[model samples]
Target: MAGIEFEIMEHIGKISEGKSGWKKELNLVSWNGNDPKFDIRDWSPDYTKMGKGLTLSAEDLKSLKNVLNEMDI
Candidate 1:
């Protein structure tokens, strides 16, 4: 059997931090050696673990940007 593979290509920024020091971050990640994508998730302090996350492609990111731009927040 083979194990899943992933690489954190870049550390973008931290969105928030939890009490235990885990951080919710946005990063560029490549899974299974595929192209990198925008990823948002919670990561352990040492980055040895991660929580569920959303991965977005360039087109998806563009759409998200558009929607966010139109938001009042």
Candidate 2:
């Protein structure tokens, strides 16, 4: 199994990853890391590492954003 290459999922300043080969990752890969989709991710911590991950399509992401924004908290 190879390591996952992560791309920043949001404009959270920098994309700081764990120490090399140390802690697991939870990447929100988008556009194959080309024209990435910097949408907020919603899933478990080790989604990719556990062989299963929740991938939100562009529309889905938009809906999620709307929902998040509507939140009062």
Give the lDDT of residue 7 in candidate 2: 55
Write model 1 residue lDDT over 1-73, tens digit each, in one string. Answer: 1386789999999999999999999999998999999999999999888888999998998999899999998
Clashes of 2: 0
Model 2 Cα lDDT, one tens digit per residue, 47-67: 344333355667787898799
lDDT values for all models? 0.92, 0.48
Shift in Å, residue 69, candidate 2: 0.3
Model number with the top TM-score:
1
Provide the global lDDT of candidate 1 against the true structure. 0.92
In candidate 1, which residue ranges exceed 4 Å CA deviation? none
